[model samples]
Target: MNAKVRLGEFLLTRRSQLRPEDLGIPDYGERRRVPGLRREELASLAGVSVSYYTRLEQGQSLNASPQVLDAIARALRLEEAERLHLHNLARSSAADPGRRRSPAPERVTEATRQLLEALAHVPAILTGRRSDVLAWNRLGHALFAGHLDPGAPERPAQRPNMARLVFLDAHTRDLYADWPAKARAVVGHLRLVAGRHPDDTALHALVGELSAKSADFASMWADHRVMACTVATYRMRHPLVGPLTVTQQTLSQDPSLGQNIVVATTEADSPARTTLALLDQVTPQHGPARPTVRAGSG
Candidate 1:
């Protein structure tokens, strides 16, 4: 996706989400054709000319100052994550256009592998920038993708992408009690990454693939929402272990790695914890019974 177009879409989406009444603008009972505040109204509130705001939203204004972006962000009432995303999108577009860089190879370091191994009982997976499962512990495999071939992550062609699984894989979809919420979170996090890594071709390809395959993904992508997922609680239904609630924490290893270790844990002494322990017992420590990571089908 082009960075300018992304910035424009982000601005447009956020603008439409804010209602005039919420921002103390009097509507005067006028029949409105557009949702939320009009372009002029937003520009007025943001202390900018309507023409300038329009140019920014049309991708014509590439040199937006940080102060100007912040003013617009305030007018739109964007959350902290969304505000950061807006700045990233603008900054990406403002960078030297002549230079280009290839996406980094997605791989888990030996040290990260050792970390996953140390947390044998915890359902934990190491993911690359595209949410590709680079590696996972035995328990994580059993908990998240037990139906797929366990050795799939070892093959780059067969690595399972969490975003793809959330939207397209029926087994993974069924595992989540709140499937829609999970899907939205995936899209939001992907948007955040897209803003920060605008030159990532792999990410753009993944987004294209998902947009073509899943209507839900397409709609969410069009909305241009942005989010950084650090911690979340989710309800999951395991075929073997029944229902359980787990909190997922995303830990960043190295800044340059662009990878996260997603670890899921249940409450202490809770029934879900007991169920997870049982799952660990039934799942082999190291063997042919590993979790399968299938290539997502279109």
Candidate 2:
């Protein structure tokens, strides 16, 4: 996945998604060959030469300024996240060529572990880029991945990916009543990661593995859906905790650790909350369950 190809593909997609009328361009009532704006029309809107836009779309001219990138983004009517992603992609390509890429994360810090331990009562987990449960609190372990061990070293390179579990693990599939929606979200998040980190060989490999293994994944990946799920309410059915309607909150990890911390909570007077309380009473203390952390499946 070369950055140029990704940039071009995204541009092409956005271009095709816009109708002439949507962009305030008058149509001549002729039958259209494509779904969206033509290349020349887009180039004209962005105030760039048609030949230059053609070259950029064809992955010939790799260098594009932030101003030019922003122009193209506005011309295509990109959303906030998409605009940021566009800049990130262009910036990544601007890095010195031939730098060895380290896609997979090795380890999170002890400070991060202490942070997780400090929030033992909250259902909080610090996840790597691939959604690897790097450090999870006791309540977090019980809430999201009940069967897994909380006290385990989840290095980015060596850990279970949450996306893999959603599709491959039977228990996880059963947990989500609307499994397809959740599945789409996982693929979408992975898609965003792929776009931002195209040089990430490990990410590419992970995506390849999932695409080959799950047909659902293959279909969604092909659709090119991309979104970041910062907040969501999940309907979960855990073996011990019964049914739960937990609202999830996501916050970015500190700069040193490029991860996200997810916290889940239920309404105070809800049955789900009561079930959580019961689960706490039954398993009050966090301990060293096993040497290894089993976050879903193979």
Candidate 3:
């Protein structure tokens, strides 16, 4: 989809999620034709004329000033990440069409590989901008996807996408104790990425595939929520290690490359930490361990 269309959809969705009462506007208890604040009401709150705001929302106007966008973001009560996403969408919409090009294939640098080796004791996975698994340490592979081939990340065609696994793979779905929360976080993060890289064909394709394959994903995508999942704690049910809670932290070695190292760590002196140690021992130095039990089987 074009940036203008995406921007319009985002605006429409966010507007529908807000009520006049949310901004202290009097509703007067009259019957309403649609949910949330009307277009004129939102324009009034953003200090813009109704026709101008309507034009922006309809994708008829692409050259929106940053000040105007910021005003609309304020009126919408967007979070910090969401505000950034709004700006990104507006900027991309105004950019020249010829500037859009296919992204280059991502690679794991030697430095990144050395860093992963150093983090062998800890579970760490390196992912590209679209969350494609680029590399992982031995323990990381064992902790996250021991059921799959250990060399899958080395093959672009077979590389596992975090978003796809979360929604479509039964093993991944079973791994998370609170599946819905994880699903929402994945969708939100993808939405944020989409706004930032509107021209990324692979990312758009992934979104399309997920939306078609999973009704849950389709619903979540329509919600238009955006989030940056940097650090979050999740309770997981490992087939071999049983139940454990770990915090996943995303570290960027190079922001310009859009590659991130997601490290999973458990609290010291906790049972989860002990569980991880056991898994680490079983994980081979070269690759993931051979699982005695299949994930999602139990």
TM-score of each: 0.94, 0.84, 0.94
**lDDT (tens digit, per residue) of candidate 1 on 1-298:** 5788888888988888888999999989998898978999999999999999999999999889999999999999888999999999999988886787887788777798789889988989888898998888888899999998777787789899999999999999999999888888899999999888899888999999999999999999898887778898999999998999999899987657679999999999999999999999999778323434589944
Candidate 1, residue 238: how far the Cα is off, in Å: 0.4
Residues 1-298, model 2: lDDT tens digits: 7777776777787788788998899987888977899999999999999999998887777668888988998998887777877776666656566884675444666787788778766678877777777777777877766765455534334465788788877878888878898898888788777767767787788888888999999988776567777888888888886888888788887634458888887798999888878777776595434345489956
* Superior candidate under TM-score, 2 versus 3: 3
**Tens-digit lDDT track of model 3 for 1-298:** 7888899999999999998887898878897898888999999999999999999988899789989999999999999999999999999988998877787889878788889989978999999999899888898888888888888888778889889989999999999999999999999999988888888988899999999999999999999999889999999999998999999998987787688999999999999999999998877777632224677888
Off by over 4 Å in 2: 26-28, 103-105, 149-158, 289-298
Model 3 vs truth, CA RMSD:
6.3
Reference-based lDDT, residue 289, model 1: 30
Rate residue 244 of model 2 by lDDT.
Answer: 80
Question: In model 1, which runs have C-alpha deviations exceeding 4 angstroms?
Answer: 287-298
Candidate 2 lDDT (Cα, 0 to 1): 0.77
Candidate 3, clashing residue pairs? none
Winning model by lDDT = 3
Task: Give each model's whole-structure lDDT.
Answer: 0.89, 0.77, 0.90
- Better candidate by lDDT, 2 or 3: 3
